[model samples]
Target chain A: MMLHNALDRYHDRPSSIHDLDPRVKVVVTLLGIFSVLLLPDGAWGAYFLVWCAVLAVALVARLGVGLVLRRSLVALPFALVAITLVFTLPGRTLFTLQLGAWEISASDAGLVRFSSVLVRSWLSVQMAILLVATTRIPDLLHALRHLHVPALLVTILAFMVRYLAVLLDEVTRLLRARQARSAASAQGKAGGSLLWRARVAGNMTGQLFLRSLERSDRIYNAMVARGFRGQYVTINPHRMRRRDWMALGLAFAALTMIQWLGRTLS
Target chain B: MNIALLTRLWEEVVVPRMHIPDGFLSMPVALIFWVITVALLLLAIRKTQQQLGERQIPLMGVMAAFIFAAQMINFPIAGGTSGHLLGGVLAAVMLGPWAGMLVMACVIIVQGLLFQDGGLLVMGANIFNMGLVTAALGSLYHGLAARQSKGVRLVVAGVLAWLSVVAGALFTALQLGFSGTSPFAIVVPAMLGVHMLIGIGEGLITMAALAFVMQVRPDLVAAEAVRTGGGRGWVIVGLVIALFVAVLSPIASADPDGLERVAIDMGFEEVAMTPPYELFPDYVIPFLGETPLSTILAGVIGALVVALVAFAVGRLLRQRAAAA
Candidate 1:
């Protein structure tokens, strides 16, 4: 239950962003990300404007700006992999440091590229986090289905999200069982060789797989008894209201203006 | 443990954690992969739909959920480190390749959209590298070892699982290099170095999991369904080889130091200098001028052309085989 809450970060606060059509939200989020991606490296003015737009959306959603900023840090670790660009890209050398025998110099161009990557990914993640926080998972999946993503793929996504909590609970209990059985030393470390621990985890994974499969079978039997077919029926008809269209138009205008600003600034 | 240390451990020590976030790739590179991933996804849908019955849909869905949850079980590795299962190969063996690809795609998509673990635009690359490549290799090797003894099949699964991880990492490195986000010489080695070790964990876990499944619900594993005919097997092999050659061609051309050194050693350097016309001279489009972007563009065009030609040749060979 704690894990479920932890995973589902959606806050049920009534706000303009949450009330927008999920499909429009998905499209606008994607448009924001694409604009961020398309902005040239080192476009500081455009980057600032985009951040402003993102913050504006966060404010509208009533999600604290600090929370979104903190959550966006998840993209940083992966961005660190691009650190090599600082030394490898050709440009005027910014500085040089002696690393044992080799002298490494960071290029000005490389620094710009690397920092822009960090900024772009950071901003993009904020948009994504805001989308997920505002829209419920099922609504988002429905939006995806309506957006012409593959039907089977959408169905599978639906089921996965549906059962993620149940399976995660099962995994939690399994981990608990393992912990109870694991013998702790004076240092409070579980007593096992590396291979033993790996084998134990693998067995648990395998056990989980078997249990999930059997559960699916039972689910299928129950569905069949209820005259369930392969297709899923949508209870609520999704229609984009006037405000949804207005929001979409506003987003496109804003993205265009931001892009134009980027070009003009550069 | 404190939250900071836990977060650090989660970020750093996780093995084979190569979900490419946004802004890491160039626009063209990301768009190309999006095209490739979508094409393959459509194909997977068609193939799975044709073969899968109504009951299998729920099974596929639950199995996707299983892969997501199973990723949480971190197996202890050396030096107090831990690794987790990606489960691409396991899913392929369990649900067969086409359905398995769907499962992996679903997990990657949800991770991107909900968890922000990956970027939305670069998701195509993420799904391609982690989902399509792993499932294809898993099915290829598993189908090859299908009729063998259980021990042999397990060994194949373990080795192929390891190979799949390395292969995914290699492609990620290639994509980064092509996008000009990172230099090829550095990123390739770094990515491969980490994944090569992590892959052993993948191998062990895959083997252990397969063995466990074999012992318990023997009927659940779909090894029989994965086995393909001789022609289809050749097509897969041919496509893989073509893909390898296409991916490697640009790198080979870019660094011909070995051949150049050989020419000098043989006293043929002077003789080799004359009569060749300039086509993509120095791997740059002449009109676009000398820039990294132009070189990357030229390289993409070159790779695409080679892959297309090889695909045509393979298609012709397949047609001939069918005619015979």
Candidate 2:
């Protein structure tokens, strides 16, 4: 259920941005991320503009801005890897720490770069979250196909999305079963040595693989019975409208302005 | 340590192996990886189609789903720590390398789009590190022992799985170092240190899963193992290229500092001091004063330790398999 909530973050809101073509949304999101990456480090003015643009897009999509911002915190853990730059980069020292025999200093330049990495990644992830929240998985896959993604790869993606929930359910069931059997220790922890616990999890994984393989065979047979072919056929395909093109143009203009501001301000 | 301090330490140390986000990588670095990823993926698509044909589509898709699900199932490692499966080598052993790569790529792309787990622009790097490299190692190492005894096969899988994680971490650190998000001297050790332990967990899980599958459904692994067994010339070439990169990374780290020294000697101090152009002081181990030699020495020592661990794990898995 938790995984389901994570996967099904899309909101069925009716707004101009929400109604935009999925392909347009996908391309615009990618372009936004690229522009964010291109911005100079410590360019707070440019980053502010980009975040404003993203918030505007969120508003247009009828999604709650606070919720979108909160959801994007998933990127923060990864941003910690850049924290090393705070001490490693050479610049005017803000402070120095004596740890035993070694002296370490944090630099003004390193702090700028580190925070820039965090802000840039945060803005980029917010854009991505907006794209997913506004677009359905099926429509996104269709957009990928229309955008000239390889046919087989698209098909593979389609299958993956379709079965993700089912497989996740199976995984949950497997875990629950393990929990029931796993006796607790005096400290109320799962009673097992490291090796034993690993063996259990690995065995469950193997079982899951076997079931998935056989399930795939059954799925293939059922598809064939229903006159399924090698390629998936869509009943109706989405087409870009005038507003979709207009939205894309607006996004491009905004991203370019943001990048220019970033360069000039930094 | 208090519970809060322990949890904070865990969060800081245990960075995930893949799923690099946006803004971490510079544009040129991201673009270079994108190009490399596209080229390799095109080859993978062609090769998988040639080998497995139409049936691979659904099968690979389901396996991708299975892998995604499997990643959620964490196993205890040591001292209340846990790690989950990446399933790259597992997929490669079950499917061939090309299909395995395709499966891994699909999972990463979906995670990026749906969960915002990785950046769209850097998906290429993620795929290259987590998918392409791991699958290649799977085929190269595990493929060699395809016809060996059951114990031998499991041992190889364990070691290869460990190697794949370390290699993925190394590639990621290289990318981050190149992108200027982190310095090489710092991030390299941090990533490698965490992943060395994580890689052990990877090894144990890989060995356990393979041992299980071999016991319950031997033919599944055997069939694909044979398929990848022959025609290993390309695999060898790939190994050579990987080793070349591994050897060159330290030199690459040292060369810029060397240039900075030369610039200083030539009285171009201001040019060398540009913030973006990082003229870092030469990085060296504390005991070893020189840059390149110390770095290379550290690398060799690290490799030797990893090799020793792999040898021990292999021996342990071999005995377990033989006993079973």
Candidate 3:
């Protein structure tokens, strides 16, 4: 996937949700994840509620239903793995099928477990997607810093996000160069050897590492010249507005309601 | 190695090679792994600062990106399950082991946090399994092998890559066993059997990658060369062994993995969870199933959207900073 294009989408006008303080968003997202994960494994109803709540949040945030569904799809594999357990699990078999040497029997408990996993994953992923969609990476980092996350970790994340596109660009360029050279060599010879291709790919990776190191040294030297310090200072401090507090209160209320509903249902 | 020593090393030093994903692990096991991961991450940051100065930041960032991109590409393996290079060991061989660990740790952290690729609580477990164990063990293997012949070093690299996966799988089984999810006897053998095959793929990829690095930019392999006393013979030897292992791996194991085996043996097979709305029961969206196909389509679309969103965010920050 093209890294630059992926990054370019984040620059959209900050939605009302995006305008909220990053801390509020972070807390809400964490709460959403925690609530879903804490649901009992067999609690399919609780999971459905969570799914509905996530959909509601997405709707309020004006995030496209299609987009949220798409993002949640990343968790599909785990869901399938859970589904497999339904047939493989031994219990009062809901249904049985004989295939080759294996007898697959679906269990009611297995289906419940699968449903719970599916619901939990969907809710958690929605929260994450919404959080990332709303908050800029820098704002998120700033929030992380204020939340008492280690400065080094935050700095590392910020830089990694920032430089990812650049690195991708460099790799792409390197690949093109290699492809051109390979095609020329192949034209001269009948076919390119697999051994040679492997060696060439290996060389490119090494070169990339060296280039990255050299770039870092240069960047460091420049920073040093500009009176570099160990840590970076925020240019514009993120202030928590009244709306931010309101958002946080509402999130807490929603979570409390969900927990109460879960208890009542159980 | 003595059996006791081997067991100790496997448990303490090597086994947490980091390939196991979440949902495969129980909650208690995940928590323990998380605790260990956090502790190791704290240690890694401290160690990194001592060895690397300001110059390392950009380098670390670029390397993290490279690893991120590399992970996206998976090569098909046996049993319809695909495998990707863990790359922690490979990264460690080039960068110092600690620095390599730090990079891997960051990648896992981001993957866990952003993509929800792994669970938040179990992130530590994932990090320990993938980053700390693999990098440390791979580095150790390289260090010792380099002392012998270059061919031996390559073989060691390949073998270690395979071993790392086996080690990772075994640790995962132990965690499951310890959590009272599955018995050790069933879990261990099952995990070891499949991972041994997977490890061969890992070994080949790693050795080939390392050999290429050695040939192209000898400087990137400088750290490794220094550790190996600049032995060229051992490097070449290592390359040959890698080729041999790659050709031999297909004939190895032809069975379902440890997790699958335990899943089949224990009635608790239903305990394993998959992501929601996934197309195939495994994560792959079959070229059929409208709901699952749409989901896969959405993922491709979502990835594009995420990339765009991330880029825009970066540009906005840069602009705001410049304006300020």
> Tens-digit lDDT track for model 2 on B1-324?
133432332233334546798888877778889999989888888887778756667888889999887877777676666777888888888887788889999988987888777889999999998888887777754435676788878877886787678778778977876677766555555565566578878888888888999999988888777775534463564354346445644553444454345434644232223223222222322333344554564476357445534554565478689999
RMSD of 1: 9.1
- Output the lDDT of residue A165, model 3: 60
What candidate 1 gets wrong by more than 4 Å, as runs, is A1-9, A187-192, B1-16, B222-231, B234-324
RMSD of each: 9.1, 6.6, 15.0
- TM-scores, all models, native as reference: 0.84, 0.86, 0.73
Best-to-worst order by TM-score is 2, 1, 3
Residue-by-residue lDDT tens digits, candidate 3, B1-324: 133432232222122233333444555566767787778778878877876777677667667767654543233444445445667767676676667788888777776665556666466787877677766655554434544455666766676676566556555555654433333333334445556556666676677777766666655565654642413332333333333223222211112244345544554433443212211232222232223333343244234334433543454476589899
Q: Which residue pairs clash in candidate 2?
A: none
* Residue runs of model 3 more than 4 Å from their true location after superposition: A1-11, A88-90, A173-200, B1-25, B72-84, B146-149, B172-194, B223-324
Candidate 1 vs candidate 2, DockQ winner: 2
lDDT of candidate 2 vs native? 0.74
Expressed as tens digits, the lDDT of each residue in A110-228 for candidate 1 is: 79888988999899999999898888877888899899997788888877787877887787778767868986778776657777777888899899998998899998899899887
- Arrange candidates by lDDT, descending: 2, 1, 3
